[model samples]
Target chain A: MFRYIVRRLLQGVLTFFGATFVVYCLMFAGGGDPIQALAGEKPVTAQQRAALTEQFHLDDNFFARYLYFLKDFFTGNLKSYTGRDVFENVGSALQLTGKIALIAIIFTIVVGVTLGIVAALRRGGIFDTSSLILTLVVIGIPSIVLAPLAQYLFGIQWKIFPVNYTFEKPFVSLILPGLVLGTLSLATAMRLTRASFFDNLRADYVRTATSKGLTRFRVVGVHVLRNSLIPIITFLGVELGNLMGGAIITEGVFNIPGIGGQLYKAIGLDDGPTVITFVSLLVVIYIVANLVVDLLYAVLDPRIRYE
Target chain B: MNEHLLEVDNLFIEFHTRDGVSKVINGVSYHLNAGETLAVLGESGSGKSVTAQAIMGILDMPPGKITRGRILYRGRDLLTMSKEERRKVRGEEIAMVFQDALSSLNPVFTVGNQISETLRKRKGMSKADAMKRAVELMDQVKIPGAKERVKDYPHQFSGGMRQRVMIAMSLAMDPKVLIADEPTTALDVTVQAQIMDLLAELRRDLNMAMILITHDLGVVADVADRIAVMYAGRIVEHADVHALYKNPAHPYTKGLLESIPRLDAKGTELATIKGLPPNLLRPPTGCAFHPRCKYAQDICVTTTPPLLDLGGGRTSACHFAKELLDGRI
Candidate 1:
């Protein structure tokens, strides 16, 4: 197991460098003046431009500059275009996005799994039909459309929740947007769960378990649920990175101060340092999520030993 | 001792499909006494496995419905029992070993966990106690290195070994009746014999009544005390094993016997019943097997023969049963 984990981490490190290199290449491909402050409203003097150029080694070739950026990035000396520490800016934004994603994911798993099981148990019945329709409608509604409507109905009209996020009650502010953010994924997970549960419920082993005098609850819970989770877990694992990407839209709609929000600003301004660090973080998230899922497979199924 | 440990009286099983309700088991009846092995012989779709499923109360409902039947266990009608009561009787009093051992056992669980689950749930044994008993049951089933192999999952075991694990699981509660539905059908020829030998030894050792559902006459000849031959969802003939083989009273049974390859008749075309088994969707008007029976007569085409009791514990559902017995057909 240790060897397996080490191998996965090694692969992840290689992917991290490759992903960052691609992003760097894309940034350089634009062929814009690298030393210019794209965000600054003030006109720059020649002396200021020359000073910035010398400070950043903008005159060097692409590979030389990339190597210099890599050295600075590794040594934690990389800075944003606005002269702020890139690590400090991205780190704080990351923490907020992490919180929202964590809550949304938890909500997704609970509601999706419960509804999925219920739908499977009542297959071809009223509950199953309704669940399918409800999930379809939720999946159909884009968060862009859902966010403003939710703000109107629940925030402005009903006055139940704050119109925008507030720092005083961080968790309270997250509830509505987190649920909104989780809706699409919840519906997707529900469908996957229902499919996998239906398949496992029909398996011969389930019949064997029931024949052994197990109660209906035990039969479904222990036998069917464990068997059905393989597909569900795999889906969730792959969705982790997408969840963060999705948070960009959700945080924007709710005006939440998170990494997704920072990412939006960075893209609008085309800040190379901020975009590079933020995107690299997403790549890391994707690689780590896959590793976790692979490791979980061994834990969930004894037949899949690491060896 | 109870004369009949388990009995199915005039059972009628039906399958509701997209087309219509198809009667699968038409008034089939059989019984098993304590320590007796009754082999239910039939081709596919003859409802042999369905009969066993009905007995175990594990029939997939919706598609399968027991339109009419009474499953009696120790003189109590199990059909009338509550779901909870039936559950109590299922693994504790009567257990079943299904066909395709690999698919029947849960893939993710260890063989020991699967066996011990019933011991823990039905028998209310402690975890440690259940584990110990599971190891012992594995050993009893003649699985070599039981203690070490208990930790292995079902996929790790070979086909024959997996069947042995299933047998051990069913025997966990020391059930009075064990319904083995085509248990050896998924194994190789040599493995089939070994499994049958293991089943026979287990039956004798446990003093358990068994319903051996099989399509092979050769398989039943060695282990079964009595044979019930079914055709078109009904028992066409039933008698002591020796008597049925020596003098098959029903023409269908006679046809089945002749179809078996004999070493004495080498190089000859193997005898085969001319037509296919009757489609249960719309069975023939009179005897369902008439189209496939050479001895089928005029009356056989107009009326379904009742299962008549011929003294000496023999029953045959063919009108020409007596003629066949008298060598007149």
Candidate 2:
């Protein structure tokens, strides 16, 4: 088990490097000049341009420039293209992004799994049919469309929530945005849970469980649900990475300062280093989430621990 | 009659599906008494397992509806009982060990947890007590290092050990009647003998009535006192194991006995009953086995045979049962 975990750690590190490097290269080669973005609406003076170009090593070869960025990145001295510290800016964005994503994950696990089990048990019944339709609709509506509409209905019309996201009273302030951020994944989790539950329900062990005289609740809830969990957990782990990456639009609508917003702004302004840093962090989050998923599999399935 | 621990009477079960109603178990009847073993022997799809499932009250419902039946346990009709009442009878009064231990036991849980949790839930024993009982039960079933192995999952054990764990789980409740449905069917030949030995030993020690359901005639030869030979969801013959094997009154039973390979009669073409069992969805008009019977006649093609008493508590569902028993044909 120890060796297995060590191997996972090594794999995670390699994937992190491989993914981050690819993203960094893509951002560097992307069209639009960060120097021009930084200069804003002002007309460029030759002296100003030359000074800015030399300071940022505009003449350096692609490989040499990447090494310089890597040096700053490794040393924790990396700066945004606008001459701001990348870590400080990205760190604050990460905090808000983490909050919304955490809530979204919690909602998906709690509500999504419950509905999935219900729909599977009473398949073809009212709850099942409605949940099926609801999930399809939820998956259809992208965050760009859902964010503002939810804000209008619950925030402005019903006055049940704040129009914009607030850090305080997050249960109320962040709930709307959190749900908006989670809608797509929430639907996927529901469908995955439902399908998985259906598969396990008819398994021979379930009949043995019923033969054991276990109550319907215990048979379905404990025996069937425990076995059904592996797929849902896998989906949730992968979805966590996606939630962090995709929260940008929901955060944008809510005007919540998060990695999504930071990444978006960096992209629009052609700030290569900032974009690379935020996206790399998201990659790191993905690696860690997958590592955690492997560990969880060991818990849920004893057969895994032997390897 | 009331001395019988459990009984299934005229039980007719059919699967109602969109395609058609498949008659799975038609007028199957049998009973069990304490401290005895009854073997329900048949090939696959002969409704032996379905009969057991019906008695256990675990048959899948919407698809599996009992058209008519009375499962009497100690003078009470199990079929007429309320859901809760029937539940109380299951596991506590009667428990089952399914055919394939690998699939029958829950994969994610430890074998001990599966057994112990039952004691905790149904018996209301505390965790420690239930766990202690689980280990003891495992040890009782002759599983080595029961204490340590109790923490292991189903996949961790060999096929034989997994079946032992399943038997142990069923015996947890000290059920009056234990139904082992093809328990050793999935085991190795060497393992099959060992499992059968263990089951027989356990049955004797517990004085528990056991229903051993299997397709292997050899499996029930020594362990079973009474054997019910079924074909196409109906018992073609029922008798004492020794008597039935020596002199089968029904042609189907005689054919089944002949089909078993013999070392004493070597170099002879192994006898096989011609034709497959009829499809239950649209079974043959008369005796379900008539199409496959060498003795099939005009009457058999048009009429189903009812169980005819042949004295000495034996019965055979064949028109020529008397002639066959008298060896006149």
Q: Which tens-of-lDDT digit does each residue in A1-307 have in candidate 1?
A: 9998998899899999999999989987866654554636778788978877787777889899889888988899998766789899877777777777777788889999889989998999999999999999999999889888888888899988777888887877777787777777999999999999999999999989989999998999899999999889888887766776547777898888787888888766757777888888899888888888888888887778784
Candidate 1, pairs of clashing residues: none
Q: What is the interface RMSD of candidate 2, in Å?
A: 0.8
Tell me candidate 1's interface RMSD: 1.1
Off by over 4 Å in 1: A32-41, B1-3
lDDT of 1 at A215: 97
State every prediction's TM-score relative to the real structure: 0.97, 0.97
lDDT of residue B125 for candidate 1? 88
Q: Can you write out model 2's per-residue Cα lDDT over A2-90, one digit (the tens) per residue?
A: 88888878988898788878887787667577777888987888898898788777788888888888898999998886788999997
Q: Write the per-residue lDDT of candidate 2 for residues B86-164, one digit (tens) a residue.
A: 8888898999999899999999999989999789998899999999999999999999999999999999999999999
Instruction: Provide the lDDT at B202 for model 1.
Output: 94
What lDDT does each candidate get? 0.88, 0.89
Chain B structural similarity (TM-score) per candidate: 0.98, 0.98
Candidate 1 DockQ, CA atoms: 0.78
DockQ of 2: 0.82
